[model samples]
Target chain A: MSMPYWRAAGMTYVGYANACAVLVRKCMKEPFKSQTATRERVHFKLSQWLDGVPQQPIVRTSDDGGGGGGGGVGKK
Target chain B: MASGSARPGSMRLAKLLYGNVNSYLSSGAAGINGGGAVWGSTTGLSSAELAPFGARSASGQIVRNRMKSVKSIQKITKAMKMVAASKLRNIQVKAENSRGLWQPFTALLGDAPATKVDKKLIVTISSDKGLCGGINSSVVKYSRALFRLNGLDGPDKDVKYVIVGEKGKAQLQRDSKKLIGMYFGETQKSSICFTQCSMMADEIIKSNEYDAIQMVYNKFNSVVSFQPTVATMLSPQLLLGDQEVTGDLDAYEIEGSDTKEEVLQNLSEFQFACTMYNAMLENATSEMGARMSAMENSTRNASDMLDRLTLTYNRSRQASITTELIEIISGAAALEG
Candidate 1:
C-alpha cells in the first residue's frame, strides 16, 4: 500500500495536523494573529523523580515562530 | 425641732434616689459587658478587653480589624473574578472554533457504543488549580459513575484510565491507583494548543492496548452552566471490523493512494487528537466560567459580611457614648446637690 505524504515523511498524523494548525494560526490577519501567536506560546517546568522523591524543577519557555517546529513532545 | 426632723427626712430620701441611680448604671454596664463578651469570640479580642468600659475601645479595634480583612478579601475575589471573566472570553472563542476540527469526524465515525468493548480506556480532563466551584468534582464524579456503569465492581481489571491534568490524577489516585495507565499535568497553566493535544494523543495511542477510548470532560453550555460529557472514539481495528462503520466509510471517496485500512488508521489517529484538542479547550473554558461565578459569589458574600459588621460596630459605638453621657449627667447632679 502506498503511504500518505506525512507517513512517508516519517511524521504521524497528529504531527501533520498540528503542523497544519500552526500554519493556519500564523497566516491569519492582525489582532487574532497576535492573539493566536501568544496563545501558541508554551511554558513548561521539567523535574526529575528519583526513588519516589522529586528533585528541583527546570523551567523552559518557548515561542513557536511560524512553522519553526520544535520537539513535539519536549517543546510543543 | 421642726428643722431637725425635716433634714433627717430629706437625707433618707436623697439616699434612696442615689441607690436607685447606682443600680440602673450598673445594670446598663452589665448589658454592655454581655455584648462585649459575645463580640470577643468573633473579633478575637483579649480577655482583658472584657473589663467594664474597656470593652468599648477594644470592640471598636476588633471591628476595624475585621473590616480591614473583609475589604482585602473582597478585593482579592473581585480581581479573581475579573481575571476569570477575561480568560473565559478568550478561551470560549477558541473552544467554539476548535469544535469544527472534530465535528466532521464525529459525524463520519458515529459513536461507538460502550456496551461490548473488551478493553476500555477512559480519558478524564480536569485542571491543576482549584477554587473553580464544582467543575473538577463534577468531572470526577461523572467518571466514577462511568466506571460503575461499565461493571468495574471491584478490581477494575479490563478498564484503564488516562488522566489529563493534575486535579484528576490527585482525585482518581485514591480509589483506582492501579487502574491509571498514564497521567498528564500542567495543560491549563497557559492556553492549550493543538500540539500539546497531539502529543497527549500520541502517547495514548502508543500504548495500543485498549479497544476503545472514552473522553470525559466538562462541556460548556453557557456562562453559568456546564455539563459533564463523554465522547467515545473507537479504535481503527474496531472501526474496520464493524459493518456499520465500513458502510459509512464506503460513502466517502478516498483521495490518497494508500489502502483503506491505512487511511482509516490515519483518520482514527488524527480524530483522536482533534477530539482531545476540542475537549481540552471546552474543559478550559468551563473551568474559567466556573471560577468566575465562584469568585463573584465570594465577593458578594464578603461585602454582605462587611455590611453586618459595620452595623454592629456603629451600634456599639453609639451605645458606649450614650452610657458615658449618662454617667456624666448623674455625677453633675450629685455635685449640684
Candidate 2:
C-alpha cells in the first residue's frame, strides 16, 4: 500500500492529526474557539536524570492563538 | 540501667505497630521495674503505684500522636477524592464523545475476533501516577492472563508488548521484560488527545509487523466500578484475507479516485488510531473513577482508625483521672481516722 501524503512527508500520524485538529480549531467561531484553545493548551515539564539525581527541568508549552499550532508533545 | 528501660518501651511500640491493643495495655506492668517519675506527672504518687500510671500517660501520648497522623492522612485522601471526582466528570463527557469516533469504523470494517493471527501486539493501557486502586494492576494482570491463555508465556512467543504508561511498564517489566517492544509515558500529566493517540498508533504500527493488535484497558462501567476489557484491531492483510466476498462492507461504494485496496488500507490505519483514542479515553475515565473510589476507601479506613484511637486515648485519660481521685479520697479517710 502507498503511503499517505503525510507519511510521504516523513511526518508521523500525530503531526498530521495535530495539523488537522489545529485547522479545525481555527475554523471554529466564538466561545468554542476560546474553549478549544484553552483545552488544547499543552504545558509539561521534562527533566533528564543522571545516575539517581534529577537535573533541571525544562518546560515545554504550546499556544495556538497566533496560528503557529504544531509543537512537539510526543516523547518516545 | 538505660537498656532495661528502653527494652519495654520498644516492645510497647512494636505491639502498637502490630495493632495488638490488648497486649499493649497488659504490657504496662513492664514499666514498673524502670521506675521513672510517672512520665513527669507526680500527681498523688504513692511510690508503689507510679509505674502503671507512667505507662498509661505514655501510651496515651502515643495514641494521640497516631490519631494526629491518621487525621492528616484522612484529609489528604479526602482531597484526592474530590480532585478525582471533578476530573472524572470532565473526562467522562469527553470519553462519551470519543466513543462516536470508533463505532462507525467498526461497523464499516466488520468487527472480527482475531483467532488465526500468527503475530500479535498487546497494548496495555495504564496511568503514570498511582493511588488509583487496582486499575493498573488489573490491566497488568489481564494482559498477563492473555499471554498465558495464548501460550505466549514462553520465553520466545509470537506476542509482543506495547506498554502505554509508566505504571504498566513497571509492572510488566518484572516478568515480561523481554516481551516489551515499545514504551510510552507522560500521558497522565496532560489530557489525552486524538493527536497523541494517533502518534502512538503510528509508532506502534511502525515498530513491528503484527497480524493483530489487542488493546487492554479498564472500561468505565460507572463511578463505583470498572471492568478490564480487550479491544482487538486486525491488520489490513488479515482484514482482506478474512473478509467475505459479499459481506456488509460491499453495500458501501468507493467515491474518490482511490482504488478499493488503497481505501481499505487508509481506513484501516485511521481506524487503528480511532481505536487507540477510544481506548485511552476510556482508560483515563476508569483511572479517575478508580482513584476516586480508592481515596474514598482510604478516607473511610482512616476515620475508623481515628475513632478507635480516640476512644483509647480518652479511656486512658479517664483512668488516670480516676486514679488521682481515689488517692485523694484514701488520704482524707486516713487523716480522719
Candidate 3:
C-alpha cells in the first residue's frame, strides 16, 4: 500500500525526520513533551529507519506521435 | 545757597548710581541683557545690555530642542524593547524544540576520536545587525581566542573562516583578510531557518577544504545573558573510524543493502545539517535575548536622559522667567525714582 502522506514534501528523508521530531515535541504536552532525551532518541531512530528506506524511482511518460488523432489513429 | 547745593549733590548721587547699574548690566553678569536696557524716559540703553538675555534665550532653546529629541529617542527604544521581547518568546520556543534533533547526535559525536589537524574551518555565527550588545563581538572574540590558542592567528596558520553574518565578517576581516572563505548576508526576513543551515552545509561540504569544522556561536542561557560556545562537526570518516561509539549505536540495525560507508556518509551529512540548524536556532535565540536586554537598557537610559533634560529645561525656563521679572521690577523702581 502506497502512503502519500509518508512522502516527504520537497525534503530529504533526514530533513523530514528532523521536522517530524520538532512537530512531535510541539504537539506533546507537559512532562512527556519536556523529555528531550527521549525525543532525541526517537529522532535518531527515525533517521535510521528513513536511511534504510528504498528510494522511489522516477516515472516518465512519452507522448505518442499520433498528433491530433485519438486512440483510432494508433489502432489503424 | 545751601539749598541749591543740596539739590545738585542729590542729582550727582543719582547719576553715579545709574552709571554703576548700567555698567553692571552691560557686563553681562546675569545674561539678561537684550536689545537695550529699558530707559523708562524714552532713551533705550546700549546694545550691550541686551546680549545677556539673548544668550540666555538661545541656550534655553537649545535645551528645549534637546529634550524633544531625547523624548523621541526614548519612544523608539521603548518600542524596540517591546518588539525584541515578543520575538524572544517565539525564538526561545523554537530553540527549545529543535534541541531534540541534534542533542542525541551531539552526544554520540562527543565520544569521537579527537585528531589534531593543521587545517580547520571555523564557522562564526552572528547577526547582521549590531544593536544587540556584544552578541556578535562575543563570538568574534571567542573565535580569535581559539585562533590564538591553536596558533592559527599567524600567516602560517591554515585556518579559514565561514562567516554567517555581516557583523562577524566585518570584524574578523580586520584580523586577517586571507582567512575569510565565505560570507552569508542577513536573511531576507531577518530570521534564520533550517534551509539556510542546509545550504551552508552544502557549501561547506562542497569546499572540501578542512579536516574538521568548528562552529562558534552564542548560546542562549537566559533572557538576560548568553555565552559563547563551540561545537565541532566530525567528518564521516572520523565518526566511522576505529573510535568506539560511546552511545547506543548498536541498538539500531542497518537494513539497507548500501555499504556502511555510504550510510555513514549520509548520516554524517544529515547530522551536520541538523547540528548547524540547532546552532542557528540557538544563536538566533541568543541574539533576540541580547537585543531585548540591550534595548531595555537603552530605554532606561533614554528615560534617564529625558529626566535630566527635562530638569535642565525646566530650570532654564524658570531662570529666564525670574530674570525677566527682576528686570521689570528694577526698571519700575528706576522709573519711579
Candidate 4:
C-alpha cells in the first residue's frame, strides 16, 4: 500500500525535481548573463523555492541546454 | 513507568514490520508495508477481510495521492513542455534550412495520376526507435491501404514491401509475407546503412521486380505533429501513361540520344538517395515528437497514481490505529459489565 505511494512519490519528486532543476537553473543563473537565460532561471527557482524545495533528488541531473545548475545557477 | 508505555510501542512496531496480526489486516494494506505486491511479503494476509478498508482507502488514497502527485507532476510537465518547446525550435530551424533540398525533391515525384503506372514498389520509411504516437502504425495502415488502392492484391504477385525502419517492419507483422526487403537504423555502420536500403531499391529496379517506386513516411510538420505521406520515389518513363512502348522506338525523339538517357538515369539514382535522406530526417523528427508526447502523458499519469496510493496508505494506517483504540475501549467496557 505504502509502496505504490512512495513509487509515485519518487516519480512525482523526480518529475518535480526535473522542473525544480529547470527553475533552479534559472534562479541560479547569474543576473549578469543573458537576460532570457537569467529570467528563465529566476522564474524556475522562484516557483520551486515557493513550492517548498525538495531535500534531495534521486536522478542525478538533466544534462540538456548545456546547463545543469552550473556556473551562475550552481552558485550558493 | 516509561517502560510500560514503551512496551506497547515496541509491540506495535513489531506488528507493523513482521505482520498484520491484530486488525484483520488484508494483503493490500501490506502493499504499503513492503517494497511492492510482487514481493512474497504480501502473501498469506487476507485482503478479503478488509473489504471495507479497501473500498474506503481506494477512493481516499486515489483522491489525495492524485492531488499531491499532481502538484508535483504539473511542475514536471510544465518543465517538459518547456524542454520540448526549446528542442522544437532547433528542429524547426533545421527543417526550414533543408526545405530547399526537399521542395524540388517532392516536386520531382509527380502526382499519382493515371492507371498505366502498375507494378509498384512501396518503400515505407519508419523510425528505428519507438514511443512515437502512431507513426509506425499509420505507415503500416497506409501501406496496406495503398496496396488496395493500386488494385494489386493478388496472392501470386505479392507487393514488395521495402521496410526502412526497425520498428516499422515490426508493426507491419500482418503483412510480413509482402515484405521483400528490410533495413534498420541510422546510416552509420556498414551492417545497417543507407547504402543497404539504396542497394535494395536498385536491385529491385534492375530485376524489373517493381515498375514504380513509392515511399510512405511521416513528413515532420512541427514539434507536435508529423503527417504520414506517400511520395513517388521513382517513376519510369515508359510507365507514365506512355502507351505502346514499341511505337516510340522508331520516333524522332533521339535528338540528344546518349546525353538525355545518361542524365535521366543519374536523376533517377540521385532522386532515390535524396528521398532516403529526407526520410531519415523526417523519421527522426517523428521519434522525437512521439517520445515528447508520451513522456508528457506519463508524467501526468504518474501524478494521478501517486495521489491514490498516498491516500490509501494514510486511510489504511488510520483505520488500523482506530481499530487499536476500539479494542482497548471495548476491553474496559467488558470489565465494567
Top-scoring candidate (lDDT)? 1
Please identify model 3 stretches exceeding 4 Å from their true place.
A1-76, B1-56, B111-115, B152-157, B188-191, B246-252
Residue B163, candidate 2: alpha-carbon lDDT: 80
2 against 4, candidate with superior lDDT: 2
Q: What is the C-alpha lDDT of each candidate?
A: 0.76, 0.73, 0.64, 0.51
Which is the better candidate, 1 or 4, if ranked by TM-score?
1
Off by over 4 Å in 1: A1-11, A19-40, A43-70, A73-76, B1-55, B152-157
Native contacts present in each candidate (fraction): 0.24, 0.11, 0.01, 0.00
What TM-score against the true chain A does chain A of each candidate get? 0.56, 0.61, 0.34, 0.25
Sorted into a CAPRI-style docking class, model 2 comes out as incorrect
What candidate 2 gets wrong by more than 4 Å, as runs, is A1-4, A10-17, A24-32, A38-76, B1-56, B152-157, B245-249
Say what the RMSD of model 2 is.
8.5
Tens digits of lDDT, candidate 3, B1-337 = 2232236668887887787668767765544343244432123224333344437776566566677877887788778779888988988998888889878876766633234556777888888776787789889998887766667344565767777776887798775566666666543243455544654565466555666778899888898778788887766676667345523455567674545555566677788788788888888888888777777777777788889888888888898899999999999999999
Report the CAPRI category for model 1: incorrect
Predicted model with the maximum DockQ? 1
State each model's TM-score restricted to chain B. 0.82, 0.81, 0.78, 0.62
lDDT of 4 by residue, B243-331 (tens): 43224433536443343333344445556655655665576666567657766676666666666676666777788779889999999
DockQ of 2: 0.20
